[model samples]
Target: MNTPLPDVANSELSQALLPLDWVGMQGIDIPLILDEPGVDASVHARADLYVNLPMPQIKGIHMSRLYTLLDRFAEHQAVSPASLVALLELMVDSHADCHSSQSRLRLAFELLCKRPALVTEGLSGWKSYPVVIEAQWCEGRLSLDATVDVTYSSTCPCSAALSRQLLEQAFIAHFGAGPVDSNHVANWIRQNGSHATPHSQRSVARVRVHIDQDAEHLGLLNLIDLIEGALGTPVQTAVKRADEQAFARLNGENLMYVEDAARKVQQALATRFHASDVSVTHLESLHPHDAAASSSRRGTLPFQAFDKALRA
Candidate 1:
């Protein structure tokens, strides 16, 4: 028989002999079966899988092993908390030589749902909501988290106030203390009402939450509904004249700033979900940069710090 080649990963030693906090792949493009409970069809998703290396002498991790295990799991098991636990257990067992104990998975995909127009008859179009699910297993305990990005329109309260003041000034100048005739006022307003309209811009809100331990199913759809309902003016598709007019009325009635958007989402999620964090970013049309605000439920840890710690 011919001489067999030796495996360097297991037999060789590291040149520096130091352990790494995290050593694995990122941005891995793999197709996964996203089978949320109660959903009719499975969603095809892109995922990233990783594991930590805690041994000082091990040359490198078995990258292929991680990939193979993830592929098998995706092929067999539906994505859920229980499946995440099993996958992390397999990851730890696969690294017996290195004594590794941590594993992570991230999946990103667009949730496609049919949304009806504000005022349309038998007309609906698909709206895509960007979603991300992150799971981590550390020291035998597994945790799951998810985030959804919702885009809506936000009107600046300050800008609205300034616009109203300017309009009032114009009206006073035009009337000039004459007997205010209804037709004259109506004609003036019809012509000049929109001349000083408030500026509104497209805004985005990213709502993230830690799944409750006792929950049985994923809450992606529910979370999206909650945020959209609270905002009261989500971006729409399949719009006609009536729908556009309805949208304009909504913007006029529910004027809000970035801070208002964040608090609205935070409160909406807090009342229903166990733990939640909300970040609202308004792409200001009048400013060079976007305005952002972040909020969390009462007595909950700050989301920024917690997010950093989880990644670290």
Candidate 2:
């Protein structure tokens, strides 16, 4: 006996009244080829994508079309800001084709970086950083936002000072002379009297920016550099002896609290990117809570003025 196949419908139902926004998808994982400075060809990343559509007289959008576009992008394209803009434009155009007026896309993923070890030579490991890219097209205009999460080390100044005082007392008890020369005292204090074992605070810096049309050309590498340079010391991936020494020196020179980290990042963005809007969040390891700071330029004001406002 032959079995009969069930009939499937290719069309969707139409409604008289539609909701404000209709289409949305979440937890979509797609492998993308990403381009960054110093990296030729492409690097792999998993992207989570979501898109929204406006309904004029329909109840829903063509969700499969969005997925198909993403599939094409993942298969044979480099993911960049310009490419992202193009993708958003495509989404909006496709939405229009589906009889919609506006469209939006949100993409999130973990970007991987291969960094040399801090202590060991010729050794490397992978470090994954979180990134989010969002785009929206409405009223014939397009806007974009990008975010990155970076980790670093922060040391509390108050803790460092107290630890040093304890070490100084211990030195006085042991050495008996209590550092004869001022230079000797200073050196002894640094070596033994203070911070014999310095407190280590692991912190994360999350930065989000509204990318201007001109700044959209800036590569992810540049953004990463800005963030890491602002933080002073990024956590190491692979570590050799020499790299460990370098990182140690960096940590010793760049001790900071959560407030200091936020201020540093704010200043760096003001000087380098001159971003119109930026936000920084620091997740502190010393405490159970997190601290967040944000700075934005107002009404076409200069970045210096915005910095002053933010600081104030």
Candidate 3:
């Protein structure tokens, strides 16, 4: 028996132009093997992907091609800026060959690390940290960006002061009223500490940067380290007695609010890399809403340049 294929072009009508800014698979879970310095093995990660397409297309793109490219990247690629640029180039080339015109790629994943505890001697199992890589190419030119999300604890300065005052009043009530010195008051409070607790604010810092295609790039780990150092008190994972003590000292020494966290990150990036076009967003725990700040390096190209090139 012979099977006859139906003719789909019978309707003589043109396909409607769909202006899709972005079109691709998302929430795609895949096990990735990552390679980093100080570690000579594979680490697992899951990626969410996206790509852009042009209008007047016969149908949607072949999503499997994006996954296949990502699979290859996971098996045999580094996550550094340069590696990301190359990966984006590969995505664009592959997509163009498949879908025609230009293509874009976005991969967001969490990079897990076995961080040591603040005062503990042993290491924790694992902590997932967020990372995002994005790239686009058109007319043979490519652009790339990378981002990371870090969490840390922030002690409200105003709340800390109020707690101290309430404790001091209680102390005066117990011991006959007299002017108390700061040191003596502190010592007395430590000796007889009670229910009063300082307010804790959970904060998240997100840093995104445009990659300079020509320079030797630092990997995501480096960016993570920089952000942690800037914040001065990242939440701990694995812990021992010593680690706990160190963490306490760190919190006591570096109490801050969401604003402080954002400023610190901004200053750190500006001074270290002259990162003129980077953006920082700090999610505040003290209030219901979030606070965000953006800083750009002088003379860096704007996002519109990429947009224009892509359209051309």
Candidate 4:
């Protein structure tokens, strides 16, 4: 005869009879397929699964059950707002013994996208975007959100103006108001263009948008395109001389401050998402500190949650 395994969780009771808001596992590795354009493979995600512990009498929930349920669901389903809500419901149902009425889940992954060179035809490379999806289910109501991190090049407007002034002074000092040949001036400019260079730094923008619970597909690529378009200076990969020149031109044309970048992203997101939260940071090449700005729409993103998501 075989001996039955001990059931400590079912038998034991909580020492303190108080309900907890959330209880479960964090950073569980899993595979998820996304039903979105430009994504052909499954992405690896670090997931945080939780269910509200309503019963003070219960010692703990079935943690193993949560893992297995997520594993099974991920193996078969593509991640989307409806799919996430369904998974949250399944999580709560699986922990019925713990009297769980609400569930929350977070999936963090890097989305790899192939990007073409700025000006080089037939030259493209892959760029990885940090992404996180948070979902919640309470009774019958559902909430879903998606956050993406975009990296770009930011040339400071102030720095550009100062650089121009310095170049102007250099030109006046060199020429001394004498009549100059056009060809000679052109060659001189080509040789001495670096008299001053505007300060530029690689910057990042983190944006969060509320996803409709009933939506079928996550518009991640479209959202990224909007942000890149607004910024106009997304960091490049695999470049030729022409591509580098084109990139420099774009940087010169799209000079911005952190506030300008934040507003650009806000305007881009407004065209699609009803509510958005945007945060932009410019790692200043001039100053020891980074410049940052935030744009919010009615506090759509909770501070605690946004902080945690960013860390992930």
For lDDT, the strongest prediction is 4
- Let me know the TM-score candidate 1 reaches against the reference structure: 0.88
lDDT of 4 by residue, 33-85 (tens): 99887765589999999999988888788899999989998899998877887
Model 2, poorest ten-residue lDDT window? Answer: 301-310
Error of 1 at 98 (Å): 2.4
Q: Is 1 or 2 the stronger prediction by TM-score?
A: 1
Candidate 4 residue pairs that clash: none
Q: Write the per-residue lDDT of candidate 1 for residues 66-141, one digit (tens) a residue.
A: 8889889878987777777788889878887787888877777787788888889888888888888878777767
lDDT to native, each model: 0.80, 0.65, 0.64, 0.88
Query: What's the true lDDT of residue 147 in model 3?
Result: 68
Candidates in descending TM-score order: 4, 1, 2, 3
lDDT, candidate 3, at 167: 79
Instruction: Give the TM-score of each candidate.
Output: 0.88, 0.77, 0.74, 0.95
User: Candidate order by lDDT, highest to lowest?
Assistant: 4, 1, 2, 3
